[model samples]
Target: MNARAEAFTRCGSAITTNALTKTFHGHTVLQPTHLEIASGEILVLLGPSGCGKTTLLRLIAGLEQPDGPNMIRFDGEDVSALPIEKRNVGMVFQSYALFPNMTVAENVGYGLKVKGIRRKQRESETKRLLALVGLEDYADRRITTVSGGQRQRTALARALAIKPRVLLLDEPLAALDAVLRERLRVEIGLLLREFGITAVYVTHDQAEAMAIGDRIAVMQRGRIEQIGAPKAIYHRPANDFVADFVGTMNRLEGRVSDGILAVDAEHTQARLRVGGGDRSAVVCFRPEVARLTAGPGAIRARVIATTFFGATQRLVAEVAPGRQLQLDLASSLHFAPGQIVAFDADPQAIIEFEKDA
Candidate 1:
């Protein structure tokens, strides 16, 4: 258990949303949805802007009331009528929201001080939190003097100082540069897990979501399209939107007759033995599944371009005019524009969606 866990007498609380929903201007922004977050689990809501992810988080934080009463619960206790303060939930946002006049230690202990915590107790708790976030050395530093990453850490420490039942973060790293955002995301995930806090994180970055979330909930246009572990959500998307949103997916269209699907274009040569009967087929696969081969293979494409990644290169291949597929291969290999290449897709990796899909 964390040292602070003993002080709070509890670490996390299970969150349950029973048909939770939201609306704005007579139109529903968040569709009726049910969600469950396990105690001590980190759940990330991921999607593009205006996807209702933040709306969902606010509802749980008591910042927004759901469409119905008793729709949100914490550890099986109804907190619908409770205000944000009464709910005992801590929030961190992109702006950091620290006081410029106050020192790091004073800002962190501000909440405790407001709640009438004695000076000795508040200072001791603040000291421990600063240590947890690696900001103990900067305790006396003014908030305005710290770097972006340091400021973010101070905000996190401030939120945790209250010993709230649940932690809510809204794009907390969005204000940082790409490199700092990447580094602090891992550090933040480790800190939350070490403290064993049930946390709800909101972000549009897939890599961040994958690294921090125990489970990712992909939302689209006010509804959750898919919810599962990071691997499952990426590998087995519930629909086309989910597949495209999560990662780069190569789609091939062909005709299937007697279990064999052959691409119709004359420039393309792809024949895969599949399960469907005679009909048009749409198959999808990831870029990393393609293997370059010199011998005859199921796929033949004209290499349009190649981008050298550190360990692997991503090649854009045209199986048909204006239809390009991305293939990830070893970085050592070289390909020229308009060069014809043959590669085979892993049989198990190919996925056939419905006809209307």
Candidate 2:
């Protein structure tokens, strides 16, 4: 790594927000959010587009000022009062936002230029950053002439040029195609780790969050529903809302009696650890957990539809009229539609949540 990059790594900054809140037009967009991000760790704020994920990211970047009793701290010092440029934070936007008139190198060196750095120093630093992002030879190329991926790389170079203590990414891959998004996601993860700069990534894509985050914070209504490793968040969600939001889930909603849940009038009852709430409960199981096998506690489901997805088959089965359960099976098995198969899930695979619990 270049000396400029090395300097950013050595800072080893930390970010914390105490009751961070954002409101617009008398409506609270983000509720008070209390979060702590460790030094050099990659924290991803994930949710749908309108769920305040971007608002939270902007608040941290100082792009959106916070509202009362709220604070943003970096390296144990309050930074809420600082302007965006004064925060010394690297931010890569979803829109690459490269100046059309400037060459790749000029855009990369723009931040340094604005800081009044010497011309030779800016040139050397820009070269190092371009090489870092694998765009060294394209330095003189016009921004309009490069591919979307290259333009995104140029945006990264510009952000890093400032030697920011903390890096902020705002849906940086939303513009790329599927292949480029996948490829750059991995590459960005590598670069963040290599540079050892603390990064806060905002995105609604669960796969991206799972792929790049050291720890993920699932945001909803401007509040964090859960925060943990990707696998933990997937396998064990904090609530029904999170389970449904994070991945594909087969939800069976019904009433529970004596720690057992009845899927329907067909008398299929499964062991459930129901606590608190006399109304109804939602039993969630991943499609992959449901097996087409005849055994004790197996419920018969008629396969109504099937779709092939390369390595797996998605089988949609009906437990009752308009009540369906999805099963994920290996591609090796080609079950025909209208076939009745005994569908059962391992006890450990089932997660039950009460409607009012």
Per residue, candidate 1 scores C-alpha lDDT tens digits across 19-125 of 88898989999999999999889999999999999999999999998888999999999998788989989899879889999999999999999999999999999
lDDT of each: 0.88, 0.85
Q: Which model scores highest in lDDT?
A: 1
lDDT of 2: 0.85
TM-scores for all predictions: 0.95, 0.92
As for candidate 2, its clashing pairs are: none
Model 1 misplaced regions, further than 4 Å = 1-9, 273-279, 294-297
lDDT of 2 at 181: 97
Candidate 2, residues 1-357: lDDT per residue as tens digits?
656456667765799999999999999999988899999999999997688999999988989999964389998899999989799999999998899999999999999999999999999999988988899999999999999989998998899899887989999999999999999899988888888889999998999999999999998887899999998889899987788788988887777665556666343443344344455778888899877665555667778999999899999888776878788998898788777777677768788775764
Model 2, residue 74: what's the lDDT?
94
